[model samples]
Target: MGIVLNQSLKNTIITYLGFGIGAINTLYLYPFFLGTVFYALTNYILSWANIIMPLLAFGMQNTLVKFYTQYKTEEERSRFLSFTVLIPLLLCIPLVLIGLFFFEPISLYLSKENPVVKDYLWLIPFIGLSMAYFEIFYAWARVHMHSVFGNFVKEVGLRLFSLFALIGVYYEWISVVEFIYVTAIIYFLACIITMLYAFHIKKPVFQFSIPQNVKDVLVYTFFIILSGSVAVMLLDIDKIMLNQYIKIENIAYYSVATYIASVIAVPSRAMHQITYPITAKLMHENKHDELNDLYKKTSINLQVVGGFVMLCIFVNINQLYVMVPKEYSGGILVVFLIGISKYFDLILGNNNAIIFNSKYYRMVLFLGLLLVFLTVGLNMFFIPRFAITGTAVATLLSITLYSLAKLLFVVKRMHLYPFTHQTLYSLAITFGIFLSFYFWEFPFSPIISIGLKSALVTLLYVYINYKFVISIEINQALDLVLKKLKIRL
Candidate 1:
């Protein structure tokens, strides 16, 4: 319990820092500099690239997390590291070749409305290779329990690089075409730096020995590849499919809403990355009590923080759209629907880490593919009829079903639920604040009033939690931060 709090405190600080930068990028910079259309293009491209990354990576990142603790010998560990890194590199070459071979056909299919993606398909191999390398190094760093550097690269460094690209676009130093290449270059550089840092931590040798466990791990890797690709595709394929089925500009509208809504889920993603290894370690050490405690705390903490963000977005989203062009305001329901889904995910806490690292992890993926198919069906059905709203609806329902399935799996198999009274407490508090303002008249526009309401909601939330002590994890976390800062309180 203490250790989880301590790590979470550190992670919370880091998450906030990353979120600060992310907020600027998502809200102000992307819109102000790139415009919503170009911004959507960039986001959609990356999302598709990531969806393809797991296929190219062949599950090395996941295999790294699972097998790191199992091997003992330096020789064995070094061999495993090499295997993890090389297998992805190997997988990418063939993938790139296959993509190149099918370039015209695939591009024609994907770019039914916008064939610009054909020129962009070449960028996928570069994007995939970097994505593959970054995951390998990210895994290597996680195995050493040094998430700060990897997290910085992922959460901060990559954003910082994109920040520069936005600057270039703003200056008119490059066309959007050049902007795409520069972004891919940023990913590649981040990957190189990550691997260098991992090597500095533990110089992995290039040994290729086959241990008994190696075969089993490789089998697991194959399953993980399919599962991971499916997960990424579920999250991203809508934009790609939308491009194929409709105009490219519709993707811009959908992407903006998704980007805004996704910000609500960033804290959960950051915390899960830090928590996964520790959860794996604890489970290995027969620490079920600690594991369940951490899970409950994570669930409550995520809801509290995530609910506050959701309130702010839901309240201020109208103002936000005013900042963007009026056309994107067409996506109001898209933002609301997607935002609701992300909030539901927050309540699930570290569910992804919990299930993906567990013995019953395979079951999570099996159901995940089913949800992926469902998502595709929903997208196909909705995009043609309702357009962006349909896509958002599909995302909400598919993701909700997906999350419920994983939560059920964790509870049923482990008999460990990741919730508590405090989880309900957070929800109740959010409800009270929302109801307080639901019917209240405001002197100003939604743009102005929403911000004011958000401030009040944030204050009420903090005050109530301070008084009632929502989660012991949060209290301990505050104390840890205070002690670190040499404050008596």
Candidate 2:
């Protein structure tokens, strides 16, 4: 837990900083600077790119994390790394060729509701390829137990560049069309930088020979690709589907609301970077006891942190919406719906890492694939009738069902459960704080009101959790921070 706490904290800070920049861009810059039409176009292209990213990389990112620890000899490790890296590059060729071959009809289909997307069809695969390699390299870093730099590049670097691009658009230095292309270039550069940083972490041996367990590697990669695609599709498919049913501008609305809700996920994302490799190592070593301990700890700690963020978002949601445009305010319901779904997923902690690394992964992958169909079916049925609100409902239901299944599978197969008494206490505290704060507001500007209310909420929440000692790990963390600041608890 030492390295987990160390790196997870760093990653958490980096992710929120990224999300902070993203908040500004999503809430203010993208909407106000580019207008709704082009803003939606930007999100539409990126969402499609994200959906296709797993196939392009061939799931090497997750495959590396899962299998990297099992090999004994350095030679074998190098060979496996080579296999994970090169195979994805090789397999991407045919996928790109297929896209190019059917480019026209694909573009026509996607651009049905919004013709603006037709012009940027090329960026979809291009950006997806970039995202694929970025994750591959990021996994490369993670396997070495050095996730901070790669995480910084992913979380902070990309959003920072996008912020500058938005400024360029504001200054008339770049047209919105040019800004769109620039965003693709930003992703491409991020991929390159992460690759170099990965190489620096551990100089590549670049073995051309195949790993001894090529069969296992290939098989796992195949299942992982489908599963990875299922997960990404679940997250981004709402945006893509929105393009088909609602106007393109509605996606901009949906994106902003979802982005706000997604801030609740930062702690989970941060912890997973390191916990993933750790979970794989524990599973590979068959250390069930330690794995169960990790499962419980990650569950409670993430619940505590994620629940805090959710509380802040829920209480301040109305005030938060006041800052956005009038049209975008329709997503208020979308925030609560998506935020609850995400919080449920969050409290499950390392449930994903545990399942993906375990022997029962094949069954879970099938379940995930079926859920993908369910999500699409729900989106199709709901989006036309209810617009973005319907899409949010579909997302909430699908994600809740998916998360619940994973939780039950872990409990049944491994006899491992993440919830403890702390979990219940955390939930109780979150509800108490939310109820107390939700109806209260500062009679000030949106920014000042949010700050004042959030401060009071944070102090109250932290005091109660600290007093109860809901998690020893969290209490220890608080002690360190308070000690550093020369304060006594």
Candidate 3:
């Protein structure tokens, strides 16, 4: 718990910094600097890449995390690592060949509705290939408990580079077309850096020998591909589908709303980095008691953190939208629906890590595939009728169903639950704070209004949680901060 707390806190700060930069890029730079067409194109390209990344990598990233600890000898570990690293290339080569043979047909299919996407079709696979290797290397680093640096490069470095690229577009130093190409280059660069850092942590002793548990390893990897694909599909498929059903520019509007709502997942994202490997190791050791304890602690702590974020977003949504362009103001409902969905995901804590590392993973993958179909079905039914708002509704429905299924499976099979009495208390407090602050407004600019309201909500929320000791872990964290500042709570 000590290491988890220290590293999660550090990772949270870094993740929030990354999101802060992303907020600027998503809200101001993309919409204001780049026109909606270019902004939507950029977002669409990246979303396409994200959806394809798992297939390109062939699930090696997750396989590495799940199996890295099972090997006992250095030679065995080397063989496993070597095999996982090369497996993706095998998948990548075939994919590239297919893309080459079918490029025209594929481009026409994607761009029939939005002709702007035709020119950028090549960027999708190229960026997806880069993103695939980035995750492969990131998982390599995570297994060594060296996640912060990789997290920084992934979360902060890419956004920082994008910020520069957008500035170039703004100043006319680079054309929008060049900026699009530069985006792919940025992902490839990040991949190279992460691979290098991973090697620095522990250089792989390349071995072509087969692992002892090759059968199990291969089986797990196969199922993980589905799992990884399902997860990515849930997150990015809406953007991709939106490009199909509506004008490309509407994606830019939806992207802004989704990005704002995504802040709710930051705490879960940060905590999962360290907790993932820890969870894997614990499950491998069959330490159910400790794993159960971790499950509850993470759930409550994340709820406390993520719930506050949702509260702030729901309360300040109007002011936040005022800062963006009027064209994007239509995504208010998108924010609320997706924000609640993400908050639900956060409170489940490291449920994902636990399931992915456990034997029940294959069953979850089956469920995931069904939900993927459901998501597409819902999107197809809703998007043409309601446009961007309908897409959000579809996402909300799919994620809610998916999350509930996962929660139930974990409870029934693993006999572990993330909720406690404090779970209900946390929800009640969140509702109370939101209702109290949703209508409250300040006579100031959007920025100042957000700041004042956020500060008030945060102070009140934290003080009440601390007073009740909703989570001993959170309370202890607050106590540590106060003591460091020579102040008493």
Candidate 4:
């Protein structure tokens, strides 16, 4: 817990900084400078790349984490790392070749509704390959307990680069088409930097020998591909499907809404970076007691933090829309629906880590694949009628069912749960604060109003949670801050 909290705090700060830059890019700079069509194209390209990343990497990133600590010697570990890295590199050859062979037909299908996507179709696999190696190297660093730098590079570095690219578009130094190309280069650059840092952490021996547990590793990697694909598809599939039914520019609106709601996930994202390796280690050792304890702590702590962000976003969503272009404001319902789904996901804490590292991962993978089908079906039904908002509806229902299944599986199979009585208290407090603050708006400008109301919501939410001792971990941290400020509670 000590190391978890320490690095989690650092990662949280870094993730939010990245999200801040990203929020600026997604909400204002991209839409205002690039126009909604190209903005949607940028998002569409990246989303498809993300969907393709898992298949390209052959699930080596997760396999590395789940197996790294199991080896007994440095030579064996080196062999395993060699296998993880080299397999993904070798697999990309055939995938890329196949993609090139079918390129025109694939491009035609994707750009049916909007031909703006045709020229950019080549970029997806290039970026996906970059994203695949980035995760493999990122997991390489994480197993060595060196996640903060990788997290910074991943969270801050990419978005910071995008910020500069978008600014170049605004200043007429680069055209929007060049901005799209630059975005692909940025991802590849991030992958190279992370690989270098990982090498610095522990210089690889690059052994060509197969690992002793090669069969087990391969099987796990196979299922993890399905698992990873399921999770990524849940997050980005809506945007991809939105392209099929609606105008490309409308995805820009959905992207804005989803990005705003995604801020609530910062805590979970931060903690998962550190907790994942720890969870893997614990499950490997058969330390169920300690694993369950970590699970509960992560659950409550994330809910407390994530709930506040959700409340702030929900209450101030209207004010937020005021600052963006009017066309983008149509995504308010998308924000609310996606925000609730993300908050549900946030409270699950280490549920994903627990399942992915466990022996029953195959069962959950089957369930996840089924749910992906359900998500696609729901989108097919909803999108033709309601457009982007309907996409949000499909996402909300699919993800809620998926989350509930994961939660129940952990409880029924492992006999471990991530909630306490304090969970209910946190929910009640969240609703109370939301109701009190949601109905009115400040008389000032949008930025000032958001600042004033967010400050008030923060104070009241913190005071109530701290007053009732909702989470001991949170209260202890709050005590430290208050002590430093010489303030009494």
lDDT of 1 by residue, 167-258 (tens): 88889988767888898899999999999999999987786656558778877887788888877887888887788687777887787788
Model 2, 72-146: lDDT tens digits are 898889888888889888888887788789999988998888888899889988899999999999999999999
Model 2 lDDT vs. the true structure? 0.93
Tens-place lDDT digits, model 3, residues 200-234: 99898887677889899989989989899999999
In model 2, residue pairs whose N, Cα or C atoms come closer than 3 Å (at least 3 residues apart or on different chains), thus clashing, are none
The list of candidate 4 runs beyond 4 A from truth reads: none
lDDT rank order: 4, 3, 2, 1
TM-score of each: 0.93, 0.99, 0.99, 0.99
Off by over 4 Å in 1: 1-3, 35-37, 438-451, 479-489
For model 4, what is the C-alpha lDDT against the true structure? Answer: 0.95
lDDT winner: 4
RMSD to the native, candidate 2?
Answer: 0.9
Q: Count the backbone clashes (under 3 Å) in each candidate.
A: 0, 0, 0, 0
